[model samples]
Target: MLEIGLTMKKLKLKESTCAICLTAMKAGQGHAIFTAECSHSFHFHCITSNVKHGNQICPVCRAKWKEIPFQNPASDISHGRQRINAVGWPRDDTWMTVLRRLPPARLDTNRHIPSLYHAQEPPIFDDDETLDQQHVIAERDVSIIDGVGDPNSVGTIEIKTYPEVSAVSRSASHDNFTVLIHLQAPVTSGRHSGSSNNAELPQMSQNSRASVDLVTVLDVSGSMAGTKLALLKRAMGFVIQNLGPSDRLSVIAFSSTARRLFPLRRMTEAGRQEALQAVNSLISNGGTNIAEGLRKSAKVIVDRKWKNSVASIILLSDGQDTYTVTSPNGTHPRADYKSLLPISIHQNRGTGCQIPVHSFGFGTDHDAASMHSISEISGGTFSFIEAEGVIQDAFAQCIGGLLSVVVQELQVKVECVHRNLHIGSIKAGSYRTSITGNARMGTVDVGDLYAEEERDFLVTINIPVDRSIDQMPLLKVGCVYREPITKDAVTLEGASQVWIQRPEIIGAQVVSMEVDRQRSRIHAAEAMAEARVAAENGDLARAVSVLESCYKSLSETASAQTGDRLCVALCAELKEMQERMANRQVYETSGRAYVLSGLSSHSWQRATARGDSTDSTSLVQAYQTPSMVDMVTRSQTMLLGNPSSHRKLRQALSFPAARPQPR
Candidate 1:
């Protein structure tokens, strides 16, 4: 047995108060004083209560608490008394060095001192400076200059438009072509310096990441016994460790019912420990109530009022929801599943911001269709974890993007400026698009964007033949978003505009490789969707044939372009799908879920780490190490352009290397 002792003395002060309870402490009263090593004083009862709750650090300064001492004023007074000499108490002029070395103080009445609280006026510019400021600006310039641009500007979300053919041949009939719109969020520097009025602004992160309010809904069903539950615990531990102090977290566990193990709290040292304790306490038993889990998770978010933070939910499950009633044949999930969706996903009624719920189907037994639908309805992505030990990597990839969000409420709009131009169709995967004005205007709701994240939309335009006009306005593209740090709405317009040339002799038209690649991706997604439908209908042979045809087409495209990494990767995915569809047993077990999850990822334009892939390890490393941006980009190499194009993009963006911090 070990015993410890506390050494203490009576604290003497004119009027001292306890820091913990903020109550006055009087000598001879019943209150005891406890002092930590950092010299912060607190009431004995309050300090003891804090310690009982497993807080090993000082609440005031967040310093590690050493062995504290307890002091009693009455006992100290009885123990000893010290005497003071009075010989020099009234005559201590010898120590006054200031009076001997300096003259009397004087105030200068002519000097005008400005008020600290008053706002300063803008500086007047000379003619030369005005001329310099009036220089022509480039079409692609988006930098914010002090005193020259909007003072409230945080940064600009870049929008680039690429058409299949820059110049179309003039003909008597209307010509239709495809246009690709790419939107990328600005790279944050993690530090902002400006006027003193904005000094107290909240920073997203020291490493250029936005703060997040993440709620993790975990399944502790009977199907997750042994290895599955153990792996989940480990993956959750990794998640807890990676979150910064600015981020907030909540944990919900569900078996037959749902329970809030950890309430929404900042990811401080104590909070992380409490979250880990909650994760470790999870036990695998009872039926899976996924609806209850999602309901509880969304309630947690809806109850809390979060500001300037990215709010999201992450749900992990390994089995079907037990709340659904069986059909006549009992071979499929009944229509009752639809009733649980609205209850699972909750949107803020006041702000109208939809909280996305990213769902993870943990095993083959999980309901893939329901999981994918949950994510789709909530504007989130679905990931499939078909193998053990890969859950951590999947979670890391998801959380990594969440932590790096730089823009919110992103909206992209495209309009036909010419009277004859018309918008035909917009292909933006799973994103929602609205068209109005007789197909002359189209808008896509892009939601939030991560740092350096790229999203592309392909639009078909109907161009009318004009023989008289030399140049005609084609289309206008613009975007608007809320900056994460400042929460200011930034609108950018006229960034890209297309014009048609009507020359009698037309030059040879060059097709953009980027546009072609995106076209192929869209087609591939359609093929995958068709294959999934066939597989779901139990036509295994048809699914295999569809996959093989898509794979052959992608192979030919990849062969034509020597350095087309995305085409090659898509080919590989289709080939894998073919092999799995050919095997009836695999198709029934994990292949169906994998196909659905892949389709979800492609549609959402979010890359996920599939089972036991090399990219999974790279994604985990990206989350753990300092080269997050580089490593994450490499992990999603299939979405990147060719080597030269990628290099040019990096140079243009000029992302700074992140400094390493201790985990």
Candidate 2:
């Protein structure tokens, strides 16, 4: 028997003696006996099947076996506490030991980052004179965001490629290229996250003449009494510092009830001092009322002064919204606090405002699910501060030190009308997508790509091996978006051809190692999936071995290709997963952690988006917290009593049901 600390000699069983069923016993996710206290043991399949058929009584003893505890003189830990604790896997020697096998998190910023792009020299293409033409087709599919919003906001969509992968494939077979549909902008990190801030945010407007109206909602619950509150106010100073002369400011403080420090007003010297005084006078006393705080902030945005201004709500909270635990889903309002979405939605219609909520989750005790859902549903950004100590850091990350911060919603769609080749599927890191048009088209929720920040989707094209490639246009990729400053519809298109020839004659060469670097997450995901089938079939050893092997192969591939960012994600997640499998943490019930892994791919990228940063691997660990998945799993009452159902394989071509969507 698979053992943890149980000392009882395992009961020997015949192949035909399953305690739940009268049939033979099998091995895998849940394949064993349930010997609690009985002389005539029954098949586990028989017992469980009978119980589900409304027979809790043991067939042999006719006793109440439903709630009985099973043990062999000693019992394995309950499923809930299997190999983890409240915060997740114990942060001990075992965890650290697993981390040591991977490459160093990151090299010195100067060395790995600057030199990282040094290899990106322009390819000497003979000439663009012979290139094929692609038709420019722009379609404004749908606008989820309402109102005639942000006049100054313009969006520009560029379908471009890195210099390395820009060349048309002239090789005879197995040729590939990556075209990036830059939805928004490349994401950067906090001031010190090692980012040089290169990518410009396309349509998120930062109009100099437009007045800024930002309302910061602060949580002054008892939990914020000591160091938390002090650091919180200090962080608020950064927001105040970012305000321009024409900018407006408002502060909404909430504990049991909400109260505005000042009415919606422009930020002047006197106004700044008054806001500062209110922040200093703030004290902690009542329960957390984040809902009320957000509700009040919404009102501040509705005031006349905010019309046509750069409006936003900076929501900071260190606890769950008052009594919000009873809410069905954080997407809707509850008795404790108002749901931010209803207000955001109500305000987005007609003359109402369309301000984005920038949420900061502070302290270890904060409710991440609620915060994340609120930010996502309300079309705002969410950030986890880790602790009160990093208040300033979180503020800088969520709001930034830039004189102006622009926010916009981005949507991308790829269509394949060609008969020979078609786009199979798109893996948009952690973004959410809906497949429509009979698999011929897909719409991606790219959210907001912050200034100097970038997001990408992988286009998997189904190519025919036997098809003749006679310089025919194989794929035509295009992008449609509104420009950032002009608010005009901007669309771009690019085309590439296919030619059948031997690889050597075309003088094929290795290009930038950084091309398609984000694919590392996708590759590891593929490998992890392969290992899961083996584990569910009672081959735990094979599962661990396969996963470990996949990790090493990925590590080698990333290293040889110089996929620095992708390498970090692979090493960090693969090793951690290997440890989990080895310790039997990923037992029978759940074959793999795809839902969590899917969410993590984006989190890891966000953490390392800035150059010279590797701590994001740890961020990936947090995103895939064993408990995090368990919480989401248990949230659905259907899986509460039936734990094994979580292992059901999702449709092969479908996206993960649960996605960590960022606004």
Candidate 3:
């Protein structure tokens, strides 16, 4: 339920406040306020903006509004976003909006199965029924393990029982594994419901169908060559073979420009074969222009039909891009290949397409960092391959990622039993819990839990529940799903029983991992830069130090391939710099090359101009490491293109009047 009222002044909220930190808003601080049918008030800013662009709901109250009513640009300019929420509509286009139109919550209409109960009884066992055939209900059981001191306890599965709907979701491995999940509520009455226990609910209730649109962007760059292209083709065949008939797939291959290998097509054996053959025909040629590929892929997914699906792109590449706007001398101007893809992805997702992207870096030359960012921006995955042989597996992994997105942009709203009760923040991911003691206490297990065949995904929710014991005990869960295209929202309500409270311990494991990964990448990039600078300044020791630092940091990264590549690249660059440092010491004397040290190039030039031949031998005698002649030859390899600098040092050795110009 939603209510909209023109506010002459400020709108006040009830017990509910900001989702980031549940607290009362201070005076003069502005926030969008929402009032639900239950008279629950929530700060509008807390729910709308705190969430992504497409999601619009009162996070505290679980009320949903529409978006089309507030599409007027003038109204937006005058009243701002506050008006959009007040009107019960999406303020802007986003993936969250698309998920909102999905099916609403529905209960199984079938007969009531026995609610298993064991107040204080021995272990209960039910093995006659299979997962597919058995109807789950609220129950408790304890198992006694032979030779063990204590019995192992298992909690009951209280799933709203429904008739099994046959569903065949495409598996990433191209295996023939398919299962149906509940999708719609069947009509049932008390007496009739009890009698018709076999009536099953639709797999994937209409509310959770999760409309999706997927686009495949394949790299046809020449570097992909024979084997890489063949593997990619085979992997693609597997992907098509595994998809559910209801799902859609599109393929786009790119070299310098994008070309559709197959327009948006439904999953069919014949269709899959045609697409596979098209992929095989895709000969690798020309340069890699990723921007063009993305634009074309976006155009296909933006269609109204694909909007029913979550828009997505799968990029396969084997090397870095070559042609693009570049400033050779600008600070960090090597073209942000990784940053560019995310920008494109975000823009498309904002336009009624919650399109996530997954990347398969097919070979060592590809930019792995860029692939990862592209995946993150679109809410997808990234994988690195060492050889063409792994292409099929890589493709399968990408398919798995797509299959895992059972739900998109799922937001949870929680209400506490007490007004003062504060709910701690919840991270995104699937959670598992056990109802204990006739009362229920909720303990969330956060992380991806694979469904029988679906891919894994990360999910987070902000619930209005208390973390500490000094507040309300009961916890209520509510949620809203934003449609990827329509910008509509479907609200849902759920709850857990109350029992003896047990503290749940969660560590900062993911946070630490992210930090470490970031630090290592930054360190490696900087160390390489520093080494180059040190060599330019003729500081061999500093150059060596920078390389060593980079080498150590790379070793600490999780992936050996990433670390090894950085180590190898930096070591080679450092070696060149070290050689230059040695050669810069050569000076001229008596028209013959002479080994020298300690004297700055400037000093050497000044001394030679004054005909001070004595300084040449003196400089040489100062260091016993190597002769000036020997250093000159060694440095030639290091400073091959730095002719001006090389000439100056050699001139200084003989005439003491030459100095190389700075590069």
Candidate 4:
């Protein structure tokens, strides 16, 4: 039977002495639970107060507890405690032995804990002070200042971690973890345990298998004038040239509007060159309209009837929407990028097409809030191109990240396997699975599998594979995308092959969840910031309206995924933040007031048409806003005195007549 722990084992506490009582736990009688990678364990309850959200790490070792996976029992022979907490097969003797030993709760608490795992070496600690005490003091002293709401804050989203084949499982037990297994493998020459008997296990195939479909959407907007636009073009060129035969590509460009430069096409040499030509033709004009742009690109995939491929849309934009078209009833504005939902798109699934949209933020002004929402809704990736020159590399990385589905409806049947291991949620592109049934040592079908161009399984199992018993249980995995006979409807079938080994825990779920949480929180903060900006410009109604919408989105997202306490906190924090911004009166020097006042008074003339009285007169009515006029004069004053202020002032200037028409 598979055995899961009854309680969460606490990592060793960091303080040399307890903060409250100033004494360590009683010796032998109290257990000090150490994390798997580091020789640090807390006195069960010492670190709870410091937890901000989710799992906390050992203060001294910096070893996070959640990354450690559950291990087997036989390996824990030396640990006198009846309960065995097996880490992965010993990489080193010291690692195995040290983890196997139980620390004297009282004395070991005061001693320096060495890094005993081969994977992570002990950290150098020169100071004599207890690390935990110092850490607590430092953390507490850190001012709980308001989070930054700068433009960069709105557009920066980072992928904190990438998925790896082998990693720790992060599932809490469902009905407690326990398991039993019985395998039926063809007998071969191998030692059966320690007895003088032979055990034969089924020899399974081990061939590398993979397929991917990637769609790229780019922003060709006026704001991307210099380095930003050039970098993006170079990046697209690199992606198209290096695409493998097994991969497929589609290209779309958005200016003030969205256009499909190249429809979803195979990555053939000619097709790649044609797509490259399309990419080369892209130029900056017009404004940003990411919502409509994404909608149109997604439509291309639907029109072409592409399905079951590792579908993804990569969007690169540097600003917010200028104009948008929505439903006639105004229930859902097509132009509203922030609240665009998958269900809205799915309902209008004009054709049978489903593709994930991954987004990449280019500059500091890129609308990360909108891009992040699109990515999360589509169950795709999102990242930022931090430096200026690395655009091509960024695009290449996006292309390489797509998943390729080989087998359609894959289902694995393990004949005899039982464990208390709780199966976490499974994600396979469009195909997903949920764990069900009794925890018994018998047959079980997990889910379907997908393949990439170069075949690899993106799988995550709760337990390690080495814990196999009874000649390694047969793993039958298969898929059914379409009926062979009818060739119309989706169907399923048994796999002709068996997985010789356990699927690795790629940790894609955890990564996706974590990234989503961080991005959403940042997005909520940004929307609030933008609303405040509008408020500062004397647009109180717009500020109130936008903040209300942002609050709702944040609240709903946090509710959908219960673990995100930060988003929930931020949601409440935003209302307070916005109120403060609203309370601050917009002075005459504010950019909007200054600009508006000059335009109304006809004090500022259009540089391009200084003598065109007719044009100047017409523009004054549209451009004049008391607030904007005041701000522009102040900005001009600053620009005249300071070179640095020129760029900032330039950003505030707008010439409607000089703007080019959208292509």
Candidate 5:
């Protein structure tokens, strides 16, 4: 898949050559040639026509275009970039805007929490200049939200969250009401893949544009010579151009060494142009030094301008740390780039601040193993862009998703008021946790809550009721999070109860289908994890048996339910997936694919699931891989942080170049 042996060279454009339009260059029509480090020539219209296509790799030599007119060390001072993509301190004072503080909340006895706000502005940006307003940073950080529809309005997925459910049973059993969550996306009726099954995907509603502080860390090394570097530039373009005026951005490029392209600045017209120029001037050479780039990223991220913004770092790397240097003084031991992993995470995890580093591994040459671990430990998401073109899509999706965040740093606490009840499990967002300390308390760290993104979490509780026929409170849920717009702390609480019945009656209530679906997903994920472990240990038989048996059992259960078409197909897919495990095909990909897919697949096993329909409602476009089908959609919005790594099926799963969906 890798086209190698090409060197960066000079371009001598002839009238008959074109890289993009594939036609001859015309006189006076102009032509564009990447003359610095590449010899690709094309029609000017054909070449410059596309900015963020992620296809900037030279067609003739497969060389990626280096940003034009690379800045010298001294000359970069004027551009506010310390080195490559990193930002330097600005000379102007326009960026010193003030942020206003919120007033007291009005009391309302009817609602326990009283009033929060009409709309919270992003605390990072400034609406006024010079002096700090009622506070620091921005005066009034108002966000503009257009009409957005729920993904459920058209999606086949059925996500149901039960605050409380009936616990009445004829038999005298433990009566406990646990929070039930379900994410069901039916697929059978939409098996006609050629047609647009827009209904199969959820359209996110509640479009709100908020400010963000994003620092892009790029790997412009020899390994990233071709399409990798090209796509990264294209993706960076997507992120920079679509940034809100209040957003703060910086760029960092690293190969043998690291360089900051620009200093952290607001996304005004000048700032955007400067940032794009930096992106355009980048070139691939030397070797990878990821830690160096990350270190520079930390420098740009700590800026006061982005203090209240939804801040994060985007890292694009194709290889491991292939280059390290010894200390010049000879008094100190040489440093390993791998050792910088913890240091990089610690940089953002200082005090009360955290800068989630969304990392992307480019291709076969990429160091995905380390990159993904960094993302997980740092509480940031990980992604891989297969080869080329998908880079821009990944960026668009990631930025778009970050922009659509409804709340950040979600901390959920679950407590039980009822006696003799033990919490079995608690699911929140994409992660599920079990209560450890006491049956009374459990906590879940939900990273981000997206607009119209319904994450149905289930809390399974085991109740041992001897014989109390009275009704009582069973469960309590508490949530603490920063307001999406204002970045102020907010707490929300809710409680649910259940009734116990006589133990010796007939006809016990059937558990909700949604609950069963979620439970099934958990079991499937366990199987996948186990299978992965087995395969890694060279126990091919065990791995195959694990997946195959789980698939068979799932199929039997699904067959009992209506609409087995999708289920049957999934079972077949599982069979194929099981074979993949036996042959060692998909081990390197995401370990949580089963969990993410189960969120959708098991929903069909539940009743009240939607039948396929035709309703196209556009909403927030966040790149998420639920299954192979949804995975293919990754190409369109490819927002950089994709964790899965499918090697052989790259073309089938990869997305096209991306564009921003306006909020």
Candidate 6:
């Protein structure tokens, strides 16, 4: 056994060249290498590029790859050793004899092999590299809003309007058109705008930013007994550590019932220690009572005496709700869980301020539908933690956005200015919308705006043809919100009108790529919603079909506008969604939750830390806050008290690389 192990180690050391790159794979080199199940090693970028281009087979062996390799090749050898130990050596065979008898594996070098460096495919590598550079530039742009004018200025949110086309046909009796409203919050130097390498919490002074009042509602049910509960604790610790002294935190645990483990208090050093202690005391038992948990969390938020603070709730659960009522006959489960959505009612009883309730489905068994609905109703994003250990990354992403909020109680209004123009409809994802003033004006209640966060609203307008006017203004858009620093109301309406030229010829009207991208996103989100409903109803085939149709539609758009990053990303997402839906095992285990949460994220225009899909153009990768990306990259090393063996296993399984850039 020792001789065989030594021989294998020597062989691994000797195999220094990557099959795809045909270059030395050495430590401390710039590029990372991945080993496939067939033991064929290639550069990580090379394999990823191959997979992204719709090739799922190994480059050298043509073997179908089940999953992308994201770990160090050394781990495979370690796993091999473990398997060898599990199936103990034959008693009759000696280790030296077996080592001598084993023959060296042969590589069929005569076979033609495709290389990324091939002359015919030289553009592929360059295009991928360009895409990666574009992603970095996009992230930098998102991190720093340059045209804000004043660096010290706070509470500045910019809004831009884009029309589908610049011209409308005068021959038609009525012209229907789409308009997009894009809103962005300014980034300030006082806040953490870019990514960080260390997982340590940032230090803040007293007057840096708005104080956050965060309530964590956790599920401590029997289903979350062992590993789930432990990860939750570690995640909570990371959360607590991230908050500053100006922030206030409250902890609530639920199973058959709910109780507050810690009251809302400023996170001073002492307060943080107490919160950590409370988290450590959690024990899993009883059935899941998600409603009770939310109810308690709402009560805590309502009872808080603090004023002028940024407040929200983070609810995490691992199972379906066991909501029941006691009657004279017997205890009975509730007929519907929708009636238990208490977020709106609690908001009314409080200061009338909107409180976002970000909910996370911990594992596969959790009710994703209920969680998504809960978040949508409360103007929050729903995240699906399909894997056990990634709960920390999800929580970190949610909290990172929360802590960087720049504006509150944001409201956007679109009013038809022309007499002939009328509002058809507005699509603003999960945000609440209302039509007022005889359907001429539409209002969207966008609860909060994070620094550097972008949101889009698509509005359809009905225009009556009029040859008398060469150009006409159709709609007037405006924004009203409260600045977090001064708690003062600010209204913006500059350059918010949409106008179209009434051309007699009606020649080819130029389309706005930005507007078209957003339109495709809204359509894709609707399709995802349909697929999610079908899957939940046990019609996997119908769900798969719906996603396939959507993918086809988006793919056409993507192919036409390959330069549009958002459009291409949406197409990739739809393709991934359809592939997951087509597989029965994947859909049931993690796909259902993934699809539901992804739909919610899309509809709500929020980013999540769900799957580790290495697609660089993915919305999650593009929109994720820098702090979120950093924390997710370093989650495995964030030690919370766990058995060394368990930690080692987690470290081995955890992919240390950040989501790969395009290259």
List model 2 lDDT by residue over 1-663, tens digit each: 323221111256544333222244444435344453333343342333333434333333232232432312222333233522222212111100010021222222442211111234222311111111110011021122321353333234334333223233433334334433433342211112222321111111223122356778889888877557655765665456445434667788888877776655444444454455556667788888777677667766654332432467788887767644455665533342234334552324122245667676665466655665555455454565542334454454444312233233455656655565555566765456666666556666553333444455666554344434434344445544433222344445432222223222444555434443445556776666666566657677887787788677777763435545446555655665555556344342111332222333343233210101123111222222221222222221111113332122111111111221221
Q: Is 2 or 6 the stronger prediction by lDDT?
A: 6
Model 3 residue 209 CA deviation in Å: 7.4
**lDDT (10s digit) by residue, model 1, range 53-110:** 3445443333434343222223322445321112111101111011112232233355
Better of 2 and 5 by lDDT: 5
Off by over 4 Å in 2: 1-158, 162-212, 302-305, 308-310, 327-356, 379-381, 401-407, 430-442, 465-468, 483-485, 493-516, 523-553, 558-563, 573-663
In model 3, the Cα lDDT at residue 501 comes to 27
Superior by TM-score: candidate 2 or candidate 4: 2
lDDT of 4 by residue, 343-434 (tens): 43331221224455656666455654455546545544445443443344445434433321222222332221323333333322222233
- Winner of 1 and 3 under TM-score: 1
The TM-score measured for candidate 1 stands at 0.69
- 3 or 4, which is superior by TM-score? 3
How high a TM-score does candidate 3 get? 0.39
Candidate 4: what lDDT?
0.38
lDDT of 6 by residue, 303-421 (tens): 55553358889999888787643345654433243577554423331234667788898767787767776776676777877666567667877877777777778889889988877
Task: Look at candidate 4 and tell me the lDDT of residue 296.
Answer: 68
Best by lDDT: 6
TM-score of 2: 0.52
What TM-scores do the predictions have? 0.69, 0.52, 0.39, 0.35, 0.62, 0.70
Candidate 1: residue 371 lDDT (0-100): 83
Each model's lDDT comes to 0.62, 0.44, 0.38, 0.38, 0.48, 0.63
lDDT of 5 by residue, 571-603 (tens): 544554464554544444422232222222232
User: Is candidate 1 or 6 superior in lDDT?
Assistant: 6
Worst-scoring 10-residue span by lDDT in model 1: 90-99
